[model samples]
Target: MTNHLEGVYQIHHIFSNINYRFQQLINSSSLRLKIIYCANISNEILRFNKEQIYSLSLNESFSINLIDSLFIYLESLRITSINSNELLLFISNFQSLPCLKSLTIKLLQCDINHSQIYYEIFSLKMLKYFKLSIDDYSTSLQSSSFNPNKQMSHLEYFIIDYQCFLPSITNILSYMPSIHYVSLMKLFYYRSSLETNYPSIWPNLTHLSICLTTWDTMFECFEVLISKIGSKLKFFSFKNYHRNIDYFNASRWENLILKFMPQLDKFYLKYTENVDRILRDRDNNEETNDFTRSFWIERKWILEIEINNQNILFSILPYKKQWFNEENLFKLNQLVISRININKYNYFIQDDINRVLNFTQIYHLEITNENLFIGLLLQITNCLFELRSLKIHSLLLEDDSRDLNLKEISILYSIHLTSQIKKIYLRNLTNIKQIDFLMKFSPYLSFFKIDYLHNLDIPSILRQINHTYLNSLCFYVPTAD
Candidate 1:
């Protein structure tokens, strides 16, 4: 029967009949199996059961006798959600599984005071990858937690979510020789209370993300630490959200970036418009009216402005369209114009159009308006021919504007104007007739996103478009409405 079963590859009641059948298979000359068990089974099954199901179980502490017997045959095991008591029990019965290569234990909820997980986990000789996410307070209590001294000689990837009363850069740097990628999210603490000096180099760390929030003297303290470590830092993100902008000056930012980071590729700033304006104002003060003349001379790096202020337009322009020339200004790559009253200033239309055309390199463009006329639309489309990505927000079609129809508009302007455009975003296209006409021309478009269109036949419009190259399509409508 066993030979016949092996020939045909059938085991009907193998686990249930482990005592009678398990040893036969283990001893069989023909049978070969790599067992994988996912269900929660206990020590009682291991001791009394006749059949064997590869001897791997999810439950950590079944029974002492069962564990002892099963340890000989156990190839691999995974235990999850083990409490402090259960963890201690598993550690006490720790006989090495020679074939075990993979292990995962989630200890975010485990009680640090009662659990011996920290001490016992490092003793695992074969662990290749390890992940630990702990609450900030539990990591700082000077109890005999997991020491970083364990020679994880083979360990490749290590992730830790640490939240302690205090964060130590020295402690992290000590273990930096082995770690490749480090993600530090919301590691919040008061900087004034920290007693130790910061470290200079994190040798093997290729990637890092840190969020710091401080008050009063904390800014100065962080600045000193950053200056010391900034040379070795490759990728950096610094954000400070304070009510008083005066406290955090722009000079501090310039000193850090200009002095320290030579190989930095990407930098993100999320603060008020005043931050840039303040810097500009300071520059203008030093150079007087020759601000543009002295701008590039002092700062050798190319500065890209990500601005959302209409006031910036007014400030930069001496008198709308009359003062500023498109040829003189720096090239803008991305322009986001959102919900501003530009109808009062028709001169701005001609100036903005000229600016867009002159740049010829803008990759991303966003225009938001509730009352843009057909003439203005035509002018915009004419200039936006070089755009690679376009987004139109809250576009309202006037009843009595220019007579340029949608089909004519597409053929004459949009299709030819933006031949390189890959992504198009449209919002609040209340008019169905206009959208139906837009669907015909965009062929190279890979992404199309639409939101809040009441009258349009969405499904039919989607079917009409030849989206052979389309990678992403998104439609959003209010469920309640």
Candidate 2:
């Protein structure tokens, strides 16, 4: 087989384990290899052409020594899982893999000594692009200690997928003197207990993106951050889960940008809040044209607002593309579904009920109506061609005596076979008929979340759900029951 495929430059193998024949074939080939989910790979199988292979990607469990010994000349290496002890051992031997310029570790075992990890990672003098994601069990590094002489990393781009406090982020930035771009997957607020000094300004840093996790003192902490690095930032993006009314105050943002971020060429901001929390201000005749000011207009940044039954989203045009986005989240997408009604305070409106329906590229659809008829569901699925997930409050027939005609049945069957939906969330489900309809409608469904069984028993619902080949099943029950 290896003789027959002599010209092959790349190979991807997905297997439970590597055998002697596979090892012999890999040893003879000078191909860039991608081995996925091959667990407990023995060291003998990893003997390959180290000089011929410059890039390697592995998604499996194996000894750390294999990395240090086999990939000395590799320019890029990606590993899916690495524990703290293995990471520390690898750090101790960073000199072995001097050719490693781009390294990505997807999952690092949660350990408290993250400061040590950061310090060691910064010691990699030749690395340029590095991405690390730590598990949630790891706590933030309360204090960081770095030797300035040994920790100046030449890395130009960095992505950190762990949530860290403001001071912790600053501490990490202090060591990366050559970094031009940085992305913090989630930035948490600094607490009073963790005492640490913020770093000096990063003049070389040009691009920054942050997803703030805490609301308390979030703006204040960000303000302090801007005071240090704002002048040099050419691109900035911010995202948050909850809303503070001040975030929408365009004038405030304009003042900040003009005063500090003078070099800013592109800005992206997104914030969301639940409907109940912001409903009080919905009646107030507040103007929504703040974003239409000259500052934003001159920059050609247009504001887009999306309000659904659950939450309101505020974002700027040319929206930031996906960056480690959360899974199983269903939000209204304005790029796909347009022609929505503008609400009174210009925030929340009956947008989904608008008459103007067009071809929508939205991937997720959440129906919050009390009663969603079969015909309306068909219409929605027909328009949202890219829809992959559906969350409905209730599913029922418009009339009890009505039954589907030939066309309706035909449409339903088409949806069952052609629908891209892999997730179905049924909220306030009261009958088995709704479950039966949903199961048949989404034949490829992988995740089913039943928020509440209003009048149905838990055992019967579980028994019915047991029939589907689902990857996951979720149930939410209230205490009142």
After superposition, candidate 2 runs with Cα above 4 Å error: 1-31, 34-37, 40-45, 148-150, 191-201, 281-289, 307-309, 319-481
Clashes found in each candidate (C-alpha, N, C closer than 3 A): 9, 0
Candidate 1 lDDT over 420-471, as tens digits, reads: 6667787766665445444544556777778876667677666656666788
Q: How high is the lDDT of residue 80 in model 2?
A: 73
At residue 27, give the lDDT of candidate 2: 70
lDDT tens per residue, model 2, 306-335: 554356666765424332122422233433
Q: Among all windows of ten consecutive residues in candidate 2, which has the lowest summed lDDT?
A: 352-361
At residue 273, what lDDT does model 1 achieve? 35
The lDDT of model 1 is 0.47
